[model samples]
Target: QEELAKKQAEALKIQKKNDELRAREEQRHLAKNTRVFELPLSRYKRKDDLKDIAACLGLDLNGKIPELTSRIKAHLDSNSVLQANPRFCGLFG
Candidate 1:
């Protein structure tokens, strides 16, 4: 009976952890989706700022600000198109 109780307690802890991870993932998804199309030019004032955005987008980070801006814009545009299409999303979603 003591062993069973310990196992049950462990299971409860694991279950709670899984629930917390699931909730965190859902929040991240919501935040990413919410900011998908709301890019403002004024937000990226410095070259480092643009580099950070480029790195997040998986673009080459070795470029001038204007080049980085264009690359990020292009990537965002393509992603937005894919996101806007329900068929494309359903295939991989």
Candidate 2:
């Protein structure tokens, strides 16, 4: 009984470690495939154009211009492109 319990605990620990590794790999894969775009704030001036772009990008603007702006800001904050391009800040602001 003691040996069986030890084996079971060891198996569970290995499974947990494997699951964590798999999750980390998936996160890296997703990050690699993610595309970042720089959208001009002027696009928002035209509601229809903004909506069209958001739809094409699979973003849910939901007719809310402010929410779209926020999403753009959030993406830029986490992405490297924004750091490399000062012009992007001006364009989006």
Candidate 3:
């Protein structure tokens, strides 16, 4: 009975150590893959700056800006041409 208890205690310790190692490895992997950006859009001088940033992050910026801008203006204008609105407001909002 004593030998069986000793074996069970050793197994528990080994399992605990393995769990700790796995957690540490996962934390390191997450830190390596995560990215954070800190900047206000108003700080950018031109629309191309946004595209360049996206490109640097391995994102496809082609045609996305035009589509996004048009969609936003369409929403704000309610599909009417009579409304006078800013072209870059949608980009910032």
Q: Is candidate 1 or candidate 3 better by lDDT?
A: 1
Summarize candidate 2's per-residue lDDT along 1-93 as a digit string, tens digits.
999999999999999999997885555445433424355655555554454444434556565677776665566556646556643444454
Give each model's whole-structure lDDT.
0.62, 0.57, 0.49
Per-residue CA lDDT of candidate 3, range 1-93, in tens?
999999999999999999997885565445433423234334544445554434333444456656433443444345344132232333343
The candidate maximizing lDDT is 1
Against the correct fold, how does model 1 do in TM-score?
0.43
Query: Going through the candidates in order, what is the number of backbone clashes in each?
Result: 0, 0, 0
Question: Runs in model 1 with CA error above 4 Å?
Answer: 1-39, 81-93
User: What does candidate 3 score in Cα RMSD to the true structure?
Assistant: 15.6
Question: For each candidate, what TM-score against the reference?
Answer: 0.43, 0.37, 0.36
Off by over 4 Å in 2: 35-93
Q: Return the lDDT, model 1, position 36.
A: 41
